[model samples]
Target: MAELESPKMMPKSITFLSSLLQRVADSNDLHREFQPQKISVFHGLTRPTISIQSYLERIFKYANCSPSCFVVAYVYLDRFAQRQPSLPINSLNVHRLLITSVLVSAKFMDDMYYNNAYYARVGGISTIEMNYLEVDFLFGLGFNLNVTPNTFHTYCSYLQREMMQQPSLNLAESSLNLGRSLKVHLCFNEDETSHQQQQLAV
Candidate 1:
C-alpha cells in the first residue's frame, strides 16, 4: 500500500528512533557513545503475534533466544523484503525465514546447529538445500549477519558485574550465575578482537 501523505511534513522515524535508542542505552546502564546505526530496528507485517514461534516461545523460551532470535529474524527479513524491487512482495515464506534465521543465529552465536536433522535430514530434506538456506539466510540479513543476542548479553553481564562488589550465593546460584555470565560473552566480536580479549572485556 502507498504511504498516505499527511497534511504536513512529518519528522522522520530516524529522529524518534535515535531518542528510543538513547533511552535503551540509559536503561542498560551503558555509555551514550552508541548511535542508531550501531543498532538495528525491527520492521513490519511479520507473522502474526499468534504464530508457531510464538507458541514455542511460550512453552520453552531460551534467555538468548525465544524472544530475541525471533525478533531479530523478523527484522532482518523485513529489511530485505522491503528493499526488494517490489513493495510487499510476500515471496519469502515465514516458516523458512524463522528456521533459517535460527540456524544462522546458532552458527553466529554459539557455534551450535543441533537441528541438523531439521535442516538436512528431516523427511528427505537434502544437505544441499540446507546450504542454500544458509546462503539465503545471510542474504536476508543484508549480508551483514554479525548480530547475535550473545553480544547484547555480554554487555549486560559486564555492567551487572561492575555494579556489584561481591555478589555472594550458593552452588545453584553459582551455576546460574555462570550460565548467565556465559550468555554475556555472546556479544564478543571474534572478528574485531582476539578471543582472549573477549574474555578480558566480559
Candidate 2:
C-alpha cells in the first residue's frame, strides 16, 4: 500500500472559507468538471487500487459507502485541507471529520438512505462538533454539495443497452473491455490531453 500523507497536514490547511466565499460562491468552478453522463467514471482509479489521496477516499475503502458519498466526501476533505491548514488533527480525528463530512454532503447531494441522526448518535463526537464540521465542510466545498459523476452503474447501463443492440458482446470480460476501450479510445495527441489520459489510465 502507498503510504498516506500524515494528518499533520491539517495544520498546513488554508482555513479561510469566509475569505474565498466570493471566488466560489456557487462553486460553479468545481461543478464544471463533474460529468455524470460519461461511462466508467473511475476506470483508471479502479476500486482495488485507489490511493489515500483524500480522507474520504481513504475512509470509503474502509466504510463501504456509495460512490456519490465518496465524491462529495473527497471534494469536501480536499477543500477543507486546502482552506484550513491550522486545524490540529490526527489520523483518527481526520477520519471522524471525513465521516461527518461525507454524511452531510450525501444528505445534500444524493438520496443517502442512511439516517444522519443515527450516524451522529453512533459517532464518537459531540453534536456540536458534528455541526461545526458540517459548517466547515460546506464552506470548504464553497457551500455546493451537488456532485454527480460517471459511475460504474452508468457504464453497466450503457453496456446493457449496447448489448441489446448487438446481442453478441458478452457481459463478462467483454463488457469490462468495452469500458476500458471507451476510455482508451479517446485520442489525446496534445501534451495536456495526454497527461489527463495518463492520469485516468492509472
Candidate 3:
C-alpha cells in the first residue's frame, strides 16, 4: 500500500479548508495542460462548470462532517495522485475526484457517515457512478485508509502553519462565514478539531 500522505503543503497556520482550496485551485490552474482523453476515460466528462471551491462549499454545507475529514480527504487526494499519475486532477475530473475523496475520507474517519447513495445525491452523480468511483478509488489507493496519529498531527500542524502565513482574503472570509452559517466548523485553531478526532479515534 502507498504510504499515507498530506496536502502537498501550506504554511503552518493554514486552515485545512484553505489549504484544500488552494490545492484544488492549483490543480485547476494546471488543467489546461492535461489531456482531455485522460479525464473523459475516468469521469465520463471533459469539462466542469462548477468551481472546486463552490463544490467543496456544497459538500461542507450538506455533509455536515468534521473539518478533519477535509484534511483527510486532502491526504487521500495526494495519495491518489501519487498512485495514479495518469488521472491527475483537472477541470473535468476534479469534481468527481473531490467527491470520491471526501466520501472515502468520511467513511474512514467518521463513524456516522452518509452511505454511497446519499453521497451520490450530494455529489450530483448517480448511485451507480458513486459506487463505481468508490471502488475505483479504493483500488487506486490500495485500500490504505488507516492514518496514524503522527501522520494526522503532521497534517494538522502543517495546515495550521500555512494558515498563519497567508494573508486574509475575501475568499477566506466568505468561505469561513459560509462555513459558520452552515455550522460546518473549519478550525483555524487546530486544538478543538484535533481533540475531537482524538476522542473519536479512541
Off by over 4 Å in 3: 1-37, 40-44, 167-202
lDDT of each: 0.38, 0.40, 0.64
Ranking by lDDT: 3, 2, 1
Summing lDDT over every window of 10 consecutive residues in candidate 2, give the lowest-scoring window: 10-19
Best by lDDT: 3
* Model 2: lDDT to the true structure: 0.40
Give a tens-digit lDDT track for model 1, residues 22-74: 22223222222231221111212342344433322321222223334433443
**TM-score, candidate number 2:** 0.38
lDDT of 2 at 116: 50
Q: Where is model 1 more than 4 Å wrong at Cα?
A: 1-67, 85-92, 120-125, 148-202
How well does each candidate superpose onto the true structure, as a TM-score? 0.36, 0.38, 0.67
lDDT of 2 by residue, 23-76 (tens): 221222223244232221111222222212343334443333455454445455
